[model samples]
Target: MNTPRLAHRPVPPHRPYRSKEFPVPDTQTQPLDPVALHRDSVVFNALDCTPLAWADETYLGKLAASGVTAINHAVSVSQGYDAAAAALVGWQHRLAETDGRVFQAYGLDDVTRAKETGTVAWFAGFEDSKPVGEDLWRLAALHQLGLRFMGLTYQNRNYAADGSGESANGGLSRFGRSLVAECNRLGIALDLSHTGERSTLETIETSTKPVLVTHAGLTHFVDSPRNKSDLVVRELAARGGVFGLAAKSGFLTPDGLTRRPGAEVFADNIDYLVELAGIDHVIVGTDVGDERKYSREGMARVRRLYPEIPIVGADLDLERIHPEGLGTPADLPLITELLAGRGYSGEDIGKVLGGNLQRVLAEIWDSASGE
Candidate 1:
């Protein structure tokens, strides 16, 4: 046999396949005890599904096991004020039924207690301020319901402002400015994750208190409208604001259109921000949505499209792929391990993990107290 013609010979003009490449840390060794490293660490997940979104007791247990100390419970993404208010009441009732497995954090005391008891503190937030309604008084009502943070808009335009993805991203409208002022007065944390450029800039300038872009990527990294620019990042940090890096694959990588990279890519994005803004301004906000809803079919399609990319499975295991070594909330120790490998001191890693968010929360709560 003529060497069997090396079955499936390539045709003319065929090029050799090149293996995908990712940066590897120079240090070869990992920490001896990742669990001990994460023992005192806390995860501040800025946005996640609540009961309204189908997150149940099992889910909450998973979250607790994952090491999530607090989550900014998204109460209203598009609900009107009446509906949002009702939903808040419902959540409170559910918490009562769960025997305070989840506590709503309205002030520093609540957060401290949650930390002490190892309970998941629910920091109320509206994904879209649409519920604040045309009337600004509705904001006061929502604030009363312990809605501590407010995202000015979702993925579409609303009365307060244009969303980042809007076709015409004119900054905050007149009403939006008014709403920001009210949010400032009421002691609510302003979030600009999906706000348009103009709106984000205007809100940053208008708010007397430091605002939060709870979860987002850098514009330079992925160039998505949803990603914040370097200028915005610098300004936010200058005002003592915190930028929580998101886990959404689309905004985190250059090839978001294909495969979502793991924590390594996420860490690269974090590295960029830390390099630009320093560790004090960087924090984790996976923006990891309802884990129960992620389907195998969807992941399979993603895998096929970006064969070189690694997709975080529905189980939320970050250690398998993320360079940061963050798999689940429980796997937070991996971050310490990776940071150690990168030569980051314990202090620096602590700040990035939770200290920064704690500072921001304290500032906002203090401002509210004064008012």
Candidate 2:
């Protein structure tokens, strides 16, 4: 019998899945310990595009407090090759500056080593193919510099494909097919978070490796174009891919701009994804970033950049962008707490937290170079 490419890998009994060690009161009046559960699990954040310059001592301290094993850091997006290369080099220097607090991760072994050493492993990713710019050699070079996952487009059209904001819903271009094939050859996973719906489905069908929607929600909850349809979600799971439930309130509910969404909002989305795609294909990708983005100035700047969503209206409160109790990576354990309270088994929670994403990466990142 052929095993599913991204089948669930259960945690060993010897390993800590969850226990009653750290007692916390639950709605069911049972003992549930989310702290210990999160501490013991290999939590991986599939998408984090926070600027590298923000990784100062306090920021790094917050990351250490988050208990995350690894993160797919966006090195560049919506930019050309030169700018993207500079951004990548800048991240390398920032990682070096961490002084052993952070480790550059290229594979599962590196993730294991980071978790063992109590340091965060960071792998580089690109949110668009504009950086490669008609040169497959440039793509290989970026891969050499540690680009593990890449999207075909951001929220706009590029040389490869139309983005989610495009009206035409055009499929992948000839160059886009080449991009998908090159990503497969170079051990890089494809991401479809911001690609057009048609382009996303086509890329999944075109690639030999499993694709990832690194940070997105479901249209079943929020009717925004940024959210995936149930059809896309089902197809993604059928192809052995994983879906990351984003924590952005704008994509969680229709009234998100009017009020503060609590962690329950995220829990509900997680529940929906699990029910629709099964436990083994669901994971978390809280898209929280530097606190400055919540400020009026930052919000205005963002509005100017991507006007398609028009999320930041004058009347909308910036504080409502991220769900309460999950405003940053430091609060990620709350997902574990919420899931546990919802009666999810410890092993299943482990898969949702990071194991599923870990398995998908292992399958997609497989190549001869083994880099």
Candidate 3:
């Protein structure tokens, strides 16, 4: 399938950075206050893989403290239909138990309402499409239950498509094409972050609406196969899709495990993505997990689940997966500061912060209505 190459706005030139270091823009002028800007802006994290007890006061408190207004929370991570459905229902109940403190968002209006109410909005997302199984109706059922976005695969292949971790890039299965059509018809945005190369490209061409790479690193900076190549990234942006530059340290730096790169590296990653995908196509997607996720028990659980995936190997420190100063949602204001320090205009900074994802999501969500 031939996809028309959509033109992108001229990219801003980025200065070369020494490994693990980002140079501050040369200027004597006072830098913009990112704290204030973050507070007022409609900050959206396209994806955050942190598993949390939805009604937990501590978790809710952390979100309340963060500059983020909305988050695409991963509800299904490599789970099959039954498990995924149960998880979705559990989150729904939790949101109901939150006593209006946290709202489960279904569309752009919910985001606006969340901003106006000064509360956090959670968009239910799936990190894998295993839950769909071989049935499109199951997908529609999940969507009606608030499953807004879904990935074609996790780090491994399922019935629909191959994941990035697969040795064989078989692309999307026949079932996958049907899944894409179902997602388009149901107004559910598709995600290709952990999908295999061929599968990712195929899905982009197949989908009627813009897709999302919600959380992943760029292979240009870190030569990890888990990251997306420039070819895939550019194609995604050219088709009006959004690329979420992640905060994973291991994927962000050369010796990320011991080096423990700070927010500077993350800022640089954002800059690299903006240069490649254009500022309008980039957004923040942090994979920073919570305390339980980094616990030794958590590592054991992950290893048991996917022993072959190198990301869960014993050598990696789950706590250091994300760069310093960006380990939690509360620290997101630092991103705005770094972008401003790098000479990004307030308009562009807002776009990167959340505006870009918002625009594409609205485009995808509203596509069904237009049809």
* Number of the top-ranking candidate, with lDDT as the measure: 2
Candidate-wise lDDT, in order: 0.69, 0.79, 0.78
What does candidate 1 score on TM?
0.80
lDDT of 1 by residue, 277-327 (tens): 778888767665555545556566645543323244444343332223343
Error (Å) of candidate 3 at residue 117 is 0.9
lDDT of 2 at 41: 81
TM-score of each: 0.80, 0.89, 0.88
Model 2: worst 10 consecutive residues (lDDT sum): 10-19
The CA-based lDDT of model 3 is what? 0.78
lDDT at position 31, candidate 1: 42
Best-first order by TM-score: 2, 3, 1
Sorted by lDDT, highest first, which candidate order results? Answer: 2, 3, 1
Give the poorly placed runs of model 1, Cα more than 4 Å off.
Answer: 1-33, 50-53, 295-334, 369-371
- After TM-score superposition, the amount by which residue 197's alpha carbon in candidate 3 deviates from its true location, in angstroms, is 0.5
Cα distance off (Å), candidate 2, residue 357: 0.8
Lowest summed lDDT over 10 consecutive residues: which window, candidate 3?
Answer: 15-24
lDDT of 2: 0.79
Which prediction has the highest TM-score against the true structure? Answer: 2
- List, residue by residue over 136-231, the lDDT tens digit for candidate 2: 889989899888988888989898888988878888899999988888888898899988888887887777777899888889987877788887
Query: Considering lDDT, which of the candidate structures 1 and 3 is the better prediction for this target?
Result: 3
